[model samples]
Target: MKKRLIGALLALTFCVPATAGDITPRLSPTPEQAQAAYLSAMFLSRYHYTVKPLDDALSEQIFERYLKALDPEHLFLTQADIDAFADTRKQLDDAILQGRLSIPFALFLRYEERTAERLGYARSLLAQNFDFSQNEHYPLDRSKAAWLKDDAEARDLWRKRVKNDWLRLRLAGKDAAAIRETLDKRYTRLLANSQKSKSDDVFQTFMNAYAGAIEPHTSYLGRGSAESFDIAMRLSLVGIGAVLQERDEYITIRELSPGGPAIRSGKLAVGDRIVAVGQGDGAPLTDVVGTRVEEVVKLIRGTKDTPVVLDILPADAGPDGRHTLITLIRDKIRMEEQAAKKSVLPAGDGRRIGVITLPTFYEDFEGRRRGDKDYRSASRDVARLIDELKQDKVDGLILDLRNNGGGSLREAVDLTGLFIDTGPVVQQRRADGKINVESDSKAGAAWDGPMAVMINRGSASASEILAAALQDHGRALIVGEPSFGKGTVQSLINLDQVARSDTPKLGELKVTVAQFFRVNGGTTQLKGVTPDIRFPSAFEGDEFGETRFDNALPWRQIDPATYRPANEIRAILPELTSRHATRANQDKAFANLREDVAELIKLKEKRNLSLQEAERKREKDSREARLRTRAEADGTAGPGDDGLQSSERSLSAELAAEKAFKARKDVLLEETARIVGDEVSLLAGSKRLAVGN
Candidate 1:
């Protein structure tokens, strides 16, 4: 998970009595908070998915995990810092019980100081003109690198870092002055943002670390964050449809929701920072740097159809560069956006099959509580789409769950009902090892015709459940990369609910209370659901999924549930594999995807980056060429709209959006269509053979 940036008005300071720095620190959780931690621990040990003792060994593990969490890249904390905190490494468990969080707080103060010092060093390097002509290599990903012995080693690293930063910008057509200016502002803002961490921020960070030590998905939400989580669970809000989060002092777009204005407009993207916002024509874009993202949201949000302009710093661009302004007309949950929508893909055999792209398994809990019959959810929308597609006489259907991080679990169960005719879909194993089967209670299948379920690394949780159900039942052909293997179910336990008195609001604990299993008794925990037909994953050899997590629950299984599979596709997998191979070799898009994946694999191995100006430029040019080729092949709007992580220039939101939407289409869907067509033919052939026999 990306580091959740906790920031607000830097001006508002939280007072705490302490001795860490000139600014005293709030070094302990409140009496209620301490109680909350204990209550949470008791609940976790008693009711979590796989309970474990809060023993000395667990405490030691938690301590190390917390330290690593503080500095995953080994950038801020040094060896000395690690040694200094080693004493408390085995003490966090005891401290949590006592409501004393002084150790984590102290460590954070040191991290803040060290971070500020690094930024200071970075700032100082801006004065010295960089000599990129020197032959040197700077490490880009320092996750595996060792912590520095001292500040001198750290300063040397920072100097190279500054040079690398300058070299990259210069290669990207930025002048020396411009590069310096960008780094100056970036470092300055970064430092200022570091200082703005309040007690809530510290508590949230430490508690998250504490909770994460138990399991990756489990977390303790502070009062503010708990409220935010509530607001986010709602499906509709009038805005650009871009989820923004505070990332390194800049309000950056986190994810673009399918069918949202930002997604439709195409200008905004994940990591693009909103530097400013404007309302109406000719209105000046007001700078939003250092402002609370909530405040920024208020500024950008308005009544439906109102034009909002955003001055954005393209994701990888320098801060000093001129920003691109994107104009969007916000709407209140536009029917097209967030709703399950369908498109038709025609195969070479002249058969048209419908593809339903489900971005998330979203459910309107509030509307449902209010008894609104038309409350939106993934199942209902998909059911309606299925009905529409049936009217079109489509050959088959594809559930496109690519990039679909699962939402509501109930939605997944209900959606599975639309396919399977009254059978068990998934089984939940609780902490006590009791199994509860969630089955499709409905009598008949919504559409019994041939179907395909498309998935990728981003398809997770509820998405996994749906895809697995369809696959396990042989109701749908599973296509694409391995799904994000999240097998655990998180249940929210309000700490305040545990308390009887009216006091300061204790936060909530999102704990992994149950593990999900397929009806076949196979657990999808660490080794997510592997598709029957595989695509060359760009994620190959990378540590990005469940298996990469620290102390993740291991793969396990129990007695198979008592339910029969609809059809065992395993028998035809070899033939399917051979056919897929033949098709991929003949297809240009698959060839490109293979080459890109190979390049990615090679790039992953090449960690050290050349700092020589010529080498850097050559590398940049090569990358840009690849991106341009991909853009041309994908027929996207521009180089930026292609799947490249970095781009040369800023793009207008509208243009960017157009190309982005275009870029979303690729060989994967086309192949799935062909596969679906093959299934249709196979079904027809089987019927004829049966009749003849």
Candidate 2:
């Protein structure tokens, strides 16, 4: 099945236009196309200086790719336009071939006009009650929303959003009069920026959509902005350790890094809206409503120990608004916290267990590029860790690959070899119908112990490969939530090679090139790998998985490859499962987890704001009641201890619960160790019996 999938993907590479039956017909270049190309050339000329001689051919290709990305369904361009663009395409190609130094400015104006027109249309659509709050805590049903039914209402909403955006630009210090005066000049400069940025954005978007279409693991990162580049290179950012997304006019926290200031503060919740920001006490709050995401990010981020205050609009806040001012001290992000870490668990049965938490399969590419031998690579480090664990005489190993977004294909294959003996790890199929089998070439396994893999919706790409391969080969039992289904391959193509100019310049392009399949013939595209024993995880919402994607490839299976099981680990599967079930059923930690999930769900359901005076009071009362309930449930106070009051007892209990939870996880490790020990003993017994007979 893996081979077939690879073959199919490869076939797409060389497929002629004639063979792409029912595909939207290619349109000729429009005036917009010519302008877009010219802008791209200008951007490339300014920033990308390594590849001298920007040319028309390269620009034409970039334009065509950009157009295709913008209108993949072929709904925007007509056949006549396609034909009309032919000459322009050829002219661009010829100029690129000759390495032309100059491009006309008139082309940039057309590009600007087209882009603004398109953005205007998008802005107009955003006005209606399309419900930007779908992924927020109070998830809205667009069908039930009255605003969605009225086009006028929707357009008005978008217009207001646009107005707010302009206001934000002004706040960012853009002089209104100067902006008006330099509109043409800025557009001209932006045309060049846009051209360069278009190539970068289009390539990145395509990679994202393509990887997302294949599975969630595969992703593309074009050359980032100067700020982003600095962050990636340094593996650090100055901000509260959280990723934010815009839903409607509010900024919502999307991801929280472990041990980050936001997580440590215990104040800001995932669904809370950041409505305003202030520098310090007595500073007037700056309303950040409807701001561009990056601009907002800049305001929030700062150097370590510098404080930034946020006016948080809780998910359930009413119109009069119940907001909290949260001041967080910015700090340098710790890359080590984001990488894989190891822990040792001591079982009551005198067995030792090794647990490894893999946050992500991250690679410091810039570090690698600079020829750093000790630069972090997930697979290499993991393999070394496994060896160290074995040397420490650990009886079992639990690989926590939860929330791992894959990196480096080579690393994934190598990691798979650590668990399984020589076998095909994954199959890669290209667009030209070629299938390549990625395999583990190693001779021996690193840790042949009782092994289990923990996964969640965030586990993708190479993470999927390791989990799927282990499960398929019967090497490990998968636990926790289902893995993120993301099985695609991307290739980074340097556009500098094709540029047409003497001033070494051209951006890079990342294109989706293939799809990946596991050894058992299943593609973890839309439906991620289901765990052997499912456990509730942090990402329970619908928005985080591949199913949320509109164009994700459907999950399918092919013929399984021939491979022998390392050992009959399944013989003790029943006992292991029974033990786990018993432990979980009686586990207070598990019980608390369930309660937490329920409370979160309830909190997320609140939406409508109270407008009337009486209603506002009621709303406030209701919010207070909910908060009290939450405090009581999660607080440390316990029942009747003379020295400690109820509040103190609740705090003590909470602390105890955390300690117990960690202990319970260790118990789980011990149980796995016992299972592995039993298996090893049974094998020895059978061998002795056979010899005696």
TM-score of each: 0.81, 0.53
Q: Model 2, range 204-308, lDDT digits (tens) per residue?
A: 443343223322333434444534644543456778887776554467675677788898999987667788888766778888876656767888888788888
lDDT at 253, model 1: 85
lDDT score of residue 18 within candidate 1:
21
Off by over 4 Å in 2: 1-222, 225-334, 364-372, 500-506, 537-542, 601-693
Model 2 CA RMSD to the hidden true structure, in angstroms: 14.7
lDDT of 1: 0.76
Instruction: Name the best candidate (by lDDT).
Output: 1
Indicate the worst ten consecutive residues by lDDT in candidate 2: 16-25
Give the local distance difference test score of model 2: 0.56
Task: Supply every candidate's count of residue pairs whose N, Cα or C atoms clash at under 3 angstroms.
Answer: 6, 52
Q: Over all chains combined, what TM-score does candidate 2 have?
A: 0.53
Clashes of 1: 6
